[model samples]
Target: MTNLALLGARLLIGALLIGGAVQKALSPGDAGGMLVGLGLPFALVWPALIYDALAGLALWLGVAVRPVALSAAAYCALTSFFHLNVFQATGDAWQMTIFVKNWAIAGGCLALMVAGSGAWALRADRP
Candidate 1:
């Protein structure tokens, strides 16, 4: 049961990252605009989009899962830091909720970084 839960968590995280990357890659212009609105540099946005896509693919393939997990954890850390100020200023419950959610997701990413994807990985058969 524990193994199943871990596998489920891994798949869910992998799927979310892949889907997010696809969204950003397919609509980079829009993603870039959002990044700009977030006050990040335009140059950073394109590179970040590429990193997200590649990392997502890596995670999905279970090729170098640890590295991919670390990358995802770092990305989530940056996101959490960026939103820390928003978390402080929010009077609305929804905003506060999302801020907490981001932190929780960051925690989950960190856990994946430490726990790894285990034996059911796509790269398991590789020598």
Candidate 2:
């Protein structure tokens, strides 16, 4: 397959997680507190960062696309479910927008899992 397709797919999904990872990594105190306030454990933040960072990097580099993308898809779905009670959230409602968006991203990740990484990738096939 053409590398452009892979590049587009990777960048589209990878950038989201990469940006999230960076944001969380940089200001985890606030994020962790927010998670705790949301009834989610604060202790999960660090491991999430690591997972997002690794999966983001893997997708960005087109390495182990299937496995990482599969995990990322699950992550996206769980995060969506985690935020399911946003109607009761004390935080801004805007944070709720990503519920559907994450599902869409998960769909894209599933597509990548089936398609594998295209050309110009570090490891184009599933690991």
**Model 2 CA RMSD to the hidden true structure, in angstroms:** 2.2
- Candidate 2: which stretches are off by over 4 Å? none
TM-score of every candidate relative to the true structure: 0.72, 0.87
- Give lDDT tens digits, candidate 1, residues 19-49: 7668877877755654565687766656776
What would you estimate as the lDDT of candidate 2? Answer: 0.82
lDDT of 1 at 15: 74
Candidate 2 TM-score versus the reference:
0.87
User: How close to the true structure is residue 61 of candidate 2, measured as C-alpha lDDT?
Assistant: 91
Which pairs of residues collide in model 1? Answer: none
